[model samples]
Target: MARVKKPKAMNAQEKLTFLLSLVPFLIERERVSVAEVAEHFGVDAEQIREAVRLIAVSGVPGETSTYQYEDLFDIAWDDFEDNDQIVLTNQVALDDSPRFSAREAAALIAGLQYLSALPENADRTAVASLMTKLSRGASAQPSQLAVEDTGSDATLALIRQSVTAGTQLEFDYLGARGTRERRRVDPLRVESMDADWYLRGWDHLREAVRTFRLDRISNPRVSEQPISHSAGDVVLPDTLFESSAEDLVVTVEVTNSAAALLADYIPDGAAREQLEGRVRTTVRVSHYHGLKRLMAGMSGVATVVEPAEARRVVAEWAAAGAARYDGDAS
Candidate 1:
């Protein structure tokens, strides 16, 4: 008797992790059944084969097509078709376990473990599964890592239900300046960033994609009415994952650890370059003063890398603050 594997939709992060694990496993096994691999990884058989096909073409990016045959993953098509077996002839550098920095490892461990520990968590099974998947080849167990819960159990449960049901959400959202407004949102998905829970959604009144902190929401309700608009119609910006735009384009370089802090700000089209263990991130914003303040606050973790005018403005801001401090000393 054969156990049928159901196809499941995977998020970007999950798909990536699966692919990473798949490559190494295939390399080690040399020859394995597609169904067996799929069953082991909890994915459909087709997905496992598709992942191998994607890996066959993937390589380090360059100006020219410099992907060598040896660098790409090779699969035995004959064996794959005839016996439903995957034969990995080559998988360069994929056999080695990926190393994560202390910060990266700590963040994943803390985030997953905390969610799994929450007694009232609606997605406890999913969180527990993610924790196990992320801990593969890792030195530390995710259960040992912990982070404080960002929102109440009640709030998270309501948000999760609304998202799964495609229901309209009615809630009072407390804004940054302490202004509380009743908001009607088409629930998209609840996202966790830097240990904080945020409800990403289409705001009906504002006609925009907005992210509301789960902790700042009050009197949450799932409306009887379904979402009025398509999520496709409301385009969220790449950097901040919000639905807003400004004219000014800013480029900054930040340490890998600090990059997560500015994740919401980087647009999808923003050019990112890896340089000597740091990331050069470019983003467009309308508010110069706000950007300057943000850069100043980041201190040693971030620097204005381009657009000479922005650098000058930030410098002027630093000098002004320094002089004000000197005056206070006198």
Candidate 2:
């Protein structure tokens, strides 16, 4: 039989932190076995019991400067002492705290559903269970909510497999310069920005960390070559698109309400100014084609303001798109 290792003894600060966290856990479940709580916290049952005893006597003092019976935390003494079970008979201030509203619960459930659909999240039992728990714990019944899958399952699955096996991935990538090139990368992290999925990895061709949009990837395959670098080996930027000295600084004008949409493109400490009623901001892009695609999505709400090259690219892209429909109109 395998012997269980004992948990390290917690210091005074750690014990106090543990007790504070324990109250919420006990309140959420209403009742739980001492052994179960011990396992959840990876501590011995006796430690949990000691913590509970301390919590029972701990509470806010009344106007008289003495802790009253109602002011202190209370537990079902009979159940605790006899059955080795915990039940909070009385909670001091938490009872008056607000719970999640139906709308809030629905939004959270929707996010969990999105995570459940991701290829990286293989074990979805926890997510499904949490969704159910949120519904039961909400202030009111949440409305039905669903997230449409972006149809990148096959690509995402291959990427997940490569990352798990510590292998390299080879794919035909559509570059920001409108060029398709076969590239190999050591898969590191897969993340999402807005509705699009992106892969951040060490690109063998560039010999540096690069980000690739999933929509631009084609003919992806897991290579036999093992990954040369791991996430810990390199510094991954907090923002998806990390700006470099070589990046083009393009200025754009957008309405006040739509300015928030360019947050990812606008680097930290970048320039922003309010001109007339619109907000003008500078965004970094590796190539002009990337700006073209960005402006296409914003259409009437955004316009390229400077760097003549960026405006030219957007105008030519729009003109080319309009030209295609000209023949169809006849």
Candidate with the greatest TM-score versus the true structure: 2
For all candidates in order, the CA lDDT equals 0.73, 0.88
Clashes in candidate 2: how many?
A: 0
Q: Per-residue lDDT of 1-330 in model 2, one digit per residue for the tens?
A: 999877689999998889879999998899999999999998999999989998899877778988889888899999999999999998875744587999999999999987775545767899999999899778789999997656576788788788778899999999877889999999778898766899899999999999999999999999999999988798998888888898899999998888888888998898889888799989998888778878888978898989897888889889999999997997
Q: Write the per-residue lDDT of candidate 1 for residues 1-330, one digit (tens) a residue.
A: 999756778999999988878877886677889889989997787888788778777755334657667666677878887888889776555433466655566688676665654323557778877665566535444345665544566777676677667678899988755679999998665666554667778888888777787888999998988887545556655543442553577889999888987766777677889988789988655567757757865899898977898998899989998999999999
Residue 56 of model 1, lDDT score? 70
TM-score of 2: 0.59
TM-score of each: 0.42, 0.59
For each candidate, C-alpha RMSD in Å? Answer: 15.3, 8.0
Per model, how many backbone clashes are there? 5, 0
